[model samples]
Target: MHWQRILVGGTKGAGKAIADRFLRGGGTVIITARSAPEEETESHFVRADVSTSEGTTKVIPEMLDLFKGVDIIVHNVGGSSAPSGGFITVTDERWQQAINENLFPAVRLDRGLLPSTIERGSGVIIHVSSIQRTLPLYHSTLAYAAVKAALTNYSKALSNEVSPKEVRVVTVSPGFRETAAATRMFER
Candidate 1:
C-alpha cells in the first residue's frame, strides 16, 4: 500500500507544512494557491482561487490531469480578513471574503472531486479549521467563526453520508501558531 499521493490546497502557512510533510514522507503532493510560485518544484502547484465557482472548475480538471487522483486531501487554507477592531469594523464584503476563503474552497473541492473517490470506496479528507471557530476574542473574525461552524457541521453531515461509502472526512483545528503573520497580528 503505497499511499504516495496527496492534494494540499492552501497557500503558505500550515498548508505548506502539510504538503512538505507528505513530500518528506516520500509522497507525491499537489498544491494550489491564488498565484503560482516564481520557480518550479517537485509538487505540481496550480494557481487556483477556490473562493469562486470558476476558480474551482478550472482547478479540478487540472488536478485530475496532474495526479489522476489523490488518496488524501488535506485542506489547510483559511484565515480571517476582518479588521482587528471587532465586529463593527467588519464590512459585508469582508465577511463574504472570509467565508469564501475559509469555507468555500473546502466545500467546492469536496463537491467536485469527492464523488470519484467515493466511487472508488476509499479516501481521506482533512479540513483545517481554526480554533477561533470555537473560541473567539470578539474581533472581526465573528464571520469567520460562523463560517467555520458551518463547515464543521457540514463536515459532520458529509462524513456521515460518505462513511458508508468508504470516504473519511476529518477536521484539524489549530490554535494560534507563532507564524510571521500571527506574530504581526500580535504585534499590532
Candidate 2:
C-alpha cells in the first residue's frame, strides 16, 4: 500500500471500520475519539475529543511524534447532538455545537497537519461527510447537515489548493449506517 501511516479521527463506528481495513493491510493506524472503544484493537488509540481545540492540541503532537507525519488522514469524527425538533428547538449553542462536532475538527486537524503532508508532496486527506448534507432530515439533523455541507465545500476548496502540491483532499458522503450513535439518534 502507498499509505504506511494512517490517522482516523473517530474509532467507534465507520472510523473503526476504516482503521481496521488499514490495519489488516499492515498499515500503522492511529485512531482518536472522546472515549476508548469497547473492545481492544491493534491500532494506536488516542482518547481526545478533536471537536475541542484542547483535544486537537493534545492529539496532533502525539501523532507527529509517533509517525513524524501520516500518509493518509481520515476526518471521520462527526454527529448530530441537537434535539428532535425543527429549527426553533435548535438554539445558537446547539448550532454551534453541531458545527464544532461536525466541521471544526477536520478544519483544525487539516490546518495543523497539512503542512507536513504538503512538505512531503504526497498525501491524502479524506473528509467523511454525510448524505444528509443534500437530503437532510431537518427535524433531527438540521445543524448537522448544514455543517456537513460546509465540510464538503471545505474539502473541495482544500483539494483545489493542495492538489497542486500533490496532497489529495477528498470528501466521502455516505448514507445511513447502523451504529450505536445512530441507534441513539433513532431513539431520540
Candidate 3:
C-alpha cells in the first residue's frame, strides 16, 4: 500500500536515508530533529527533540494538522552520550538519558499516533535498533546497549498488542554502518 503521510523521527543519519527513499517514492514525508538537517531533503522538516515528551507534544499537533493523519511512522532517533565506563561507573542521569534518547521517542510517538492508526485499522511503525542491544560493548555502550535492548523488547511487545488492531509494528536491528558517527569513531 502507498503511504500518503509518513513521519520519520530523526533526520540527520539513518533516518535521513529512510526519508529520502520515501520522498523518492512520491510519499509526503515529515522528518523531525532537534536541529535542521545538514543537507537538504524533499521531505518537510519539523524541529523538535523527539526524545522528550515535551518535544513530541510540540510536534504532534503541528504534524497532525499538516498531514491530517500519519499512515506510517519510522522511529530512527537514538544515540549515546554516556561516558565510556562500565555499568558501575554509569550515573543515574546517564541511564535516564539513554532511555530518553533510544527508547522514549518511539514510545511517546506511538502512544500519540497509534490510536489514529487503530481508528483507521491500518498503519506501520518501524523502530530502528542496533545489534549492540544483544551483543553489547560494556565499556562504551553499556547504557546505550541497555536502552536499545529495552527498545527491541518494547517493539516486539507493542507489535503483539497492536497487530490484532491491524497496525503493523516492526523493529530493525542493523549492524554498524559507515555513518558520520561511526566514521569518526574509526578515525579516533
Report the number of the highest-lDDT candidate.
2
Which residue segments of model 1 deviate by more than 4 Å? Answer: 4-6, 37-40
Q: Model 2 over residues 101-125: C-alpha lDDT tens digits? A: 9899999899888888888779999
Winner by TM-score between candidate 2 and candidate 1: 2
- What TM-score would each prediction reach against the true structure? 0.89, 0.95, 0.92
9-106: candidate 3 lDDT, tens digit per residue? 54666777777788888867888888887786777888888888899997788766776668888888888766665788789998999899999988
Please give the ranking of all candidate structures by TM-score, highest first, separated by commas: 2, 3, 1
List the pairs of residues colliding in candidate 2.
none
Kindly give the stretch of ten consecutive residues in candidate 1 with the minimal lDDT sum.
Answer: 2-11
Candidate 1 structure, TM-score to reference: 0.89
Greater lDDT among 2 and 3 belongs to 2
Rate residue 68 of model 3 by lDDT.
65
lDDT of each: 0.75, 0.86, 0.82
What is the model-wide C-alpha lDDT for candidate 2?
0.86
Kindly report which residue stretches of model 3 are placed more than 4 angstroms away from their true locations once superposed: 5-7, 184-188
Per-residue alpha-carbon lDDT of model 1 for 30-137, expressed as tens digits? Answer: 778786644555777778777887888887887667666667787776666567788788788988897888788888888878876776679898888778778975
